[model samples]
Target: MDSAFFSMIFRMKYITRWGLMRSSYPETLSEHSMDTAVLAHALACIGASRLDKPVDPMKAAVFALFHDAGEIITGDMPTPIKYHDPQITEAYKRIEAEANRTLFSMLPDDLKPYYEPVFHPAKEDEAYWQYVKAADKLSALIKCIEEEKSGNSEFKDAKAQLLSMLSSFDLPEVQVFMQEFLPAFSKTLDEQSRE
Candidate 1:
């Protein structure tokens, strides 16, 4: 009879990120998810309105919001470990799938349907998923930019690698986001405040 499942998910803030690097500002899974959701929504909107691709921004946002929910169960695996090689990446994907299932099991039977789509969408929503992926990378790029701004040398190579990876996406929405939105992340507080 205990159906307070979401409260567990809400503790995503407890899952800290950048475990390997010294973060000037600590980031949590909750914060990353929120940024990913907002960026996904924005990218979806830009695609629909500007790039001639129609997508449901709200759906994309919701998908992004739950994209990292599996991290709550698996903990935040560092990217290097998660993608160290094809075998490791495939193994981690399986682990993540199980973790996602474990997360869904917490929901009450009646509410399972409501969250299932958010956790695992249908094939038709591939474009939405792609937008979420782009948003995730964009969020990471922003994090790298923030680290560089804090004068941390740790993220220097990460920023360059992220930029290279991002450019490979070749999605117009991703391109537009990089060109029109990403540059501002490099700005100073004074410059942002003035604008």
Candidate 2:
């Protein structure tokens, strides 16, 4: 049977993020996913090469790519509403799981096993998952930085919150990325080129 899996994946471009706030430059899920994947790869590489951790950069990057695949089906739920209450958060998690299952089922049966670990990560890859989570937060923080740089004060609170959340991770690789790479996001293209 033919699969609609790739077609569904392409629909990621249609899902806009930061639904509750005004954005200086609107972002699509596809863009966010790509950013997250890049960050995840960097963080994992930092962990493995610099920190002597056994993280797989490629695996983390691939996982990060699909971290929010469920959001395509559920639509982008505003963060405030998604976490307003404990029960609501739990309910949303269930809904996201169901959405992932539905998306996974779109794959051809022979390919399902290969993609299963991405949709439902194995326990052994829990450490790598942490990297993906950090990457996800970093992506959001980058968005906030860009908005603020564009003179959009709407994301100020979010920038602070994301920074705090990332700080709490206490991962050396994350700290390194924040220190070494994040500041560049606020620089002008000319300034970056001059450096």
Candidate 3:
């Protein structure tokens, strides 16, 4: 039997919502995935410690890392297309679900269980999911911070929308992270710009 790890090495093509350097960020799904994974783990750990929630931080991180694995085959559909409208959004979600099912099928039987939870997460892990969603938004917010630092107004609307999404989440730890740390990213962005 072939080892399953080789299946994951296929180079994916993604259309980034963030534009190329001239106007926007040139983010890729792979880079975004890594950031989300780290943020997910940190937020989950912080939430568990602060809120007494029994969340598996590692699992959450893993989940976030692979959450968009389906995009490898389906490609990254921007939020504008994925959520153009209620009907369009629901249809795109169904497409994503179908794509994930297809991706799960490519894995060996032994690896399926290991990946299914990430490909089609359970509702029981809602809190963990929340953290991942928050991480996604935070990642975009960080991107906007960088973009704005580069004197790009393209991400200004994105920054506002991301902050709005961040504020909508009820997690105290996440809120605290936003409150205490997010603003500093701008300074960091500015300092890094000259580097």
Summarize candidate 2's per-residue lDDT along 1-195 as a digit string, tens digits: 888899999999999999999998889999999999999999999999999997889999999999999999999999999999999999999999999999999999899988998998899989989999999999999999999999999999999999999999969999999999999999999999999
Off by more than 4 A, model 2: none
Models ranked on lDDT: 2, 1, 3
Root-mean-square deviation of every model: 1.2, 0.7, 3.2
Clashing pairs in 3: none
| Candidate 3 TM-score, true structure as reference | 0.87
Candidate 3 yields a Cα-based lDDT of: 0.77
Error of 2 at 195 (Å): 1.0
Rank order by TM-score, top first?
2, 1, 3
Q: Which candidate would rank higher by TM-score, 1 or 3?
A: 1
Using TM-score, give the best candidate's number: 2
Better of 1 and 3 by lDDT: 1
Residue 129 of model 2 has an lDDT of: 91
The lDDT of model 2 is 0.95
**In candidate 1, how many clashes are counted?**
0
Flag clash pairs in model 1.
none
CA displacement after TM-score superposition, residue 30 of candidate 2 (Å): 0.5
